[model samples]
Target: MTTTRPIQSGRRYRRIIYALIGVGIASLLGGMFLDYSLAGLVVYAVTAVGALALTLFLQFGSEIELQDEREREIGRRASDVTFQLFGYLGLVVFVAMFLLEATSQYTMTARAETLLYAYAVICLTWGGIYVVFRYRS
Candidate 1:
């Protein structure tokens, strides 16, 4: 009798991501403790770009499919959950900022406004797409 083992591509990809995360964290700490802030930022930027490229490659460039049906479904569901969670989190932050500004006479920072605007745009885009798809279907 012959037996076959399942493909471990997903496991391999996950391991790579974890390793990159570890290295990124180590680089960040080393940069901070060594008083090389610029080096740390450079390291982080490089790591971010590398990670994005690696993820795109793993997700779309692989010759073999790594995710099974169940894995894909789970990923979809997890994405939805995070999307909703982050939307709510952004709203909460916006509201908190308003309250703080009103009570403490604090002005919103440019960074905070930029973040809020980005969050709002993303949420609106998501909502618009969802509505269009739901109505069309």
Candidate 2:
């Protein structure tokens, strides 16, 4: 008799979904604060759809419908590549900005710095999660 293994990494998918939902919410809020009512509504709608999808997946998804080993492997590889690319891009942007600031009289704006900080935080969090799982396993 042969037994099949269930997709055990459902939690990972859940985390990703939740993260996306969080981003959508943040975008919505930022739009509202900036008086972009239409954009905010659009963001809210998209976030609602994402939440609905998460709910449906949690309630009705089967093991095979979740993610198999091969799918998980592909996701990991994609994530690693994306993270590396983002890191390189961020480093280039940072160095360019640093040189520009040093050589010119212009300074970084508060809004730009805030966005950069947020991106840095997101990257750090994503990388930290990857490291935790890679070493834990």
Candidate 3:
């Protein structure tokens, strides 16, 4: 590869960062798949944030481990892709929630908390990724 690739990470920290990403994704998936309850969704969102924090800490901890130009571009493109995805996902959920409320005969109340938290996760994820990408860029 070009000089753009970052130095290969040591196994320990590399494993830690990889695990953090996996756990973060798992948390998000679990939140969506679990019962349609506010509390469970909140707990899962918290877990995702914790995983995100850990990833940031390990990734930038090494001065010499900084990503090069190609890596920076990769990170940016990745975040932009993720942001578009979550943005659409959140908007669809919100629209569906409102539409269901408007026309449904059942007096079903939408869980505002769940909707808010879902959007919050999208916001935070996009923001976090944007920051990392921008900094590296």
Candidate 4:
């Protein structure tokens, strides 16, 4: 008789969490494209709540050690790069939109205005966080 090793509980839990996240994303995307019925709204709300609960459980409830120090360092570097890249890209796009409106008859759309406001907020938040961190460190 062939013997099989049982799966570790931590690994099994991680797989379940990944599957749930995938299903949640798929349902959210499906809900976005389809009609906005009451049932659809309920499904979306449930999915969102489930996802949030899973995230919180992963953060505080579970005893599973997910990432090592190296992994966390890599994640921090990636996050820093992503934040800078998006901030610069948003600034460039906002400036281009503003210049186009200034030079030509093209008027900024509501979406463009929204982007401008979002970029401003992002910059301000980043600056404030930087100041706090700089002073704290």
For every model shown, the clashing-pair count is 0, 0, 0, 0
Candidate 4 CA-lDDT value: 0.74
Cα RMSD for candidates in order: 4.0, 7.6, 8.6, 4.7
Instruction: Give the per-residue lDDT digits (tens) of candidate 3, residues 1-137.
Output: 55533455534445665676666566556656775456555655665677567656756664445455787899989978997887888788767766776788334445775666778886887689879999998
Regions more than 4 Å wrong, model 4: 1-14, 32-41
**If both were scored by TM-score, which would come out higher, candidate 1 or candidate 3?**
1
Model 2 earns a TM-score of: 0.54
Model 3 TM-score, all chains together: 0.45
Q: Give model 4 RMSD, 1 decimal.
A: 4.7
Superposed Cα RMSD, model 1 = 4.0
Candidate 2: where are CA atoms >4 Å away? 1-64
Stretches of model 1 off by over 4 angstroms after superposition: 1-7, 92-112, 128-137
Deviation in Å, model 4, residue 41 alpha carbon: 4.1
* Candidate 3 residue runs with Cα over 4 Å from true position: 1-6, 9-16, 19-62, 105-112, 124-137
Better candidate by TM-score, 1 or 4? 4
Score residue 112 of candidate 3 by CA lDDT.
Answer: 79
Between candidates 1 and 2, the TM-score winner: 1
Identify the candidate with maximal lDDT. 1
Give per-model TM-scores: 0.64, 0.54, 0.45, 0.72
**Ranking of predictions according to lDDT:** 1, 2, 4, 3
Worst 10 residues of 3 by lDDT: 4-13
Best prediction by TM-score: 4
lDDT (CA) per prediction: 0.81, 0.78, 0.66, 0.74
User: lDDT tens string, model 2, 17-109?
Assistant: 787788788888888899996897798788779877876876587553456668789998998899789888987987788788998955888
